[model samples]
Target: MKFKFSIIFSFFLYITYGQINVKGKVVSKSNQPLEGAAVFFNSTTIATITDENGEYQLTVPEGKYKLVASYLGFKTVEREVDINENTSLDRLNFTLEEEDSLLNEVVIGAKKKTKSKKPKYEDFLVFKEAFLGRTNYAEKCKIDNQKALKYYFDPATNTFSVEAKEPIIIINRDLGYKITYNLEKFQIKDRIISYFGYSQYEELEGSKRKKKKWKKNRKKAYHGSLRHFLKTFITANTKEEGFDINIMHRVRNEKHPSDSELAFSKKIFEFQDKRSVPINFNKVIVKPESKLDSAILIHQRQLKHPKIIDKLIKRNVSYSDISYRVEGKVYLKFDGFLKVTYNNEPEEFNYKRDIKRRLGVQKSNFLLFDSPQEILPIGQIADQNNRLVEGYWSYELFANALPLNYKPPKE
Candidate 1:
């Protein structure tokens, strides 16, 4: 099975009782109002289109956010705002510059018609598994616009990449959401997959019973998720929330053969057996053409283990151990990986069976690429590039995604 990781960052917002009013006007370079411009906070469902006067108003809970203004044919603009009770909402205004139409036309014309190829079924399958994920929720989700996708494969690098001509639309029946994803980048190289994008979510209309089911499903998706973990950690409620965090130390496995050694071994084996067919040089495996290949099979089994050591539990972790507060802002600064187990929920049977682990808890692994990474009050990482997630959180893809503004229903 291929291990996949996604790097998705989008605008999201959450509403609370203590709301701060934010109003803004969008204009052109000449100071003329640009009507119908989109004004919203990045990563939040709270968005509005400017009226005829090119003015928009929003009420959001006090927090730090990236305010954005976008208009067709105009360059998108983003501004960092620290919203609080004392913030001057009226001062929030934006000026958008028109995109160079001539440059856009030139870039479009540069693309060769012969190079454009229709996406194959196999390509879509790969894209779907990487994007929508292989979760049960993903099975109920469908991409509405596959035609917007463009595919490319490089045999030299063994890389497959995709680009979107327009926003990809998805209808998630299980989650009751209509998502519009602006896919900025997607690529699969050297058996590792990564994608990035911004998204807007619209709640699907449904019956009262269906809405109730959606609420329950959303809550299930939220619990034991990355968002829940972050929120619980920030509030110092790990124990109360049934989260067990521990330090996991990982290091390179010295027993793993280096690339040069593997290449040398391959050459020697080929010289000894001319009929041996090399299956994969990366794994140093060859098709057994003779009884002497039994030795190679034994070697392959030894090499099948991971290059990195796992399950090296160091010690228990506390909230203060991984994070600190600076000037009232929360920042995460930690070394090594955090192995978090949510004891409140049991691991899915499918996952448990696949991993062959009897442990009933849901577990995930997290690593920080940068120390002192700021975490917003709403449990969102200020800098997405500062952290890496693996295990369960990484497995749940766009199909299980909830809007930033989504709030758990009261029990």
Candidate 2:
């Protein structure tokens, strides 16, 4: 089974500058100042905690930003402001109301539920691996809050489902970023995982030496990433950027997917009295092999390596057309997997204790599916219609994500 991410909204982690200034105060609904409130732009490292008087100041580069203010026991607040060379923003105060944090119906036990109504321990383990990830950086990730998650398992169909009542806070010590994630939906069935969520990242404070090391690591993380590939594609620098695309086709499984593979979870009776606890999965029930030829669905099912045809020419691609966004047959979906070859290879160090590896990156090969039409802006590649292949893009998480504004350092 393959697992990958399909980003749906506009999420960015752009770098910030001090050319623009923004100041604000944080207060409660009663007009009482709230000190130590976390405030910052989404995704960027620029952020500040409120002072004793609930006042704060921030100077950033000229750009559009969603300023956020958050405090414990209060609803998070966000305001959008755009800064151009001609103007700057100031005195943007926020009044936060109390927030209601409720666990999912399962956690609060709003209705009667038995042990069988909850997710199995093994299924949950798989969910964690798919969501938090299986990489070294993911290993270093610690979820500050886990109890808020609501889980359910269906054994008859082997489907696991989960959703967070509140945001999931994670500290990525290896990557130097703290992420707050709000999960909207998640499902694991037939060894395949799919999820969509929103998130914000706050850069961790560190010493000068540690910050330097992190800078190197951040650059290393960007290589071969989807964002890296997109920027290069937009600029028509695929060869120089070390990227090659081979359009492969998917051959539909002659035998339609079994009931076990279909996304719908079969119901079960929890008690001897025949109390049926149906798994309430309110999503479109899709066959493991979705039959929409017009809209190609990306799944992680793997068969023996399949055939490849019509390898695209690097010279045929133009600066204006990057394939994923324009909607013709840019990608080929076969019923099976393709034999892939990446022009670039992962980096290998020859010497011990080499920080040089920190300064550079090795390339990785990836296979992902995209929607026939785009759900995001031109810069983003795939939408919900697309499925990420369980390779490089799936492996990389928010820990390594960068914004469209990022530019690789000149070698």
TM-score per prediction, in order, is 0.81, 0.61
Give me the runs in candidate 2 sitting further than 4 Å from their true place. Answer: 12-18, 29-32, 85-88, 91-95, 106-127, 144-169, 180-213, 249-342, 347-390, 402-407
By TM-score, the best candidate is 1
Q: For candidate 2, lDDT tens digit of each residue in 14-94?
A: 234647667889999999999988887765566788998899998777666667887766777777676665554556899
What's the lDDT for residue 401 in model 2?
Answer: 63
Tell me the whole-model lDDT of each prediction, alpha carbons only.
Answer: 0.74, 0.56
* Model 1 CA lDDT for position 359: 53
Consecutive 10-residue window with the lowest summed lDDT within model 1: 104-113
- Displacement of residue 192 (Cα, Å) in model 1 is 3.6
Q: On a 0 to 100 scale, what is the lDDT of residue 90 in model 1?
A: 87
Count of backbone collisions in candidate 1 = 8
lDDT of 1 by residue, 32-58 (tens): 998888777765677788888889998
What lDDT score goes with residue 305 in model 2?
22
List per-candidate RMSD values in Å.
4.8, 11.7
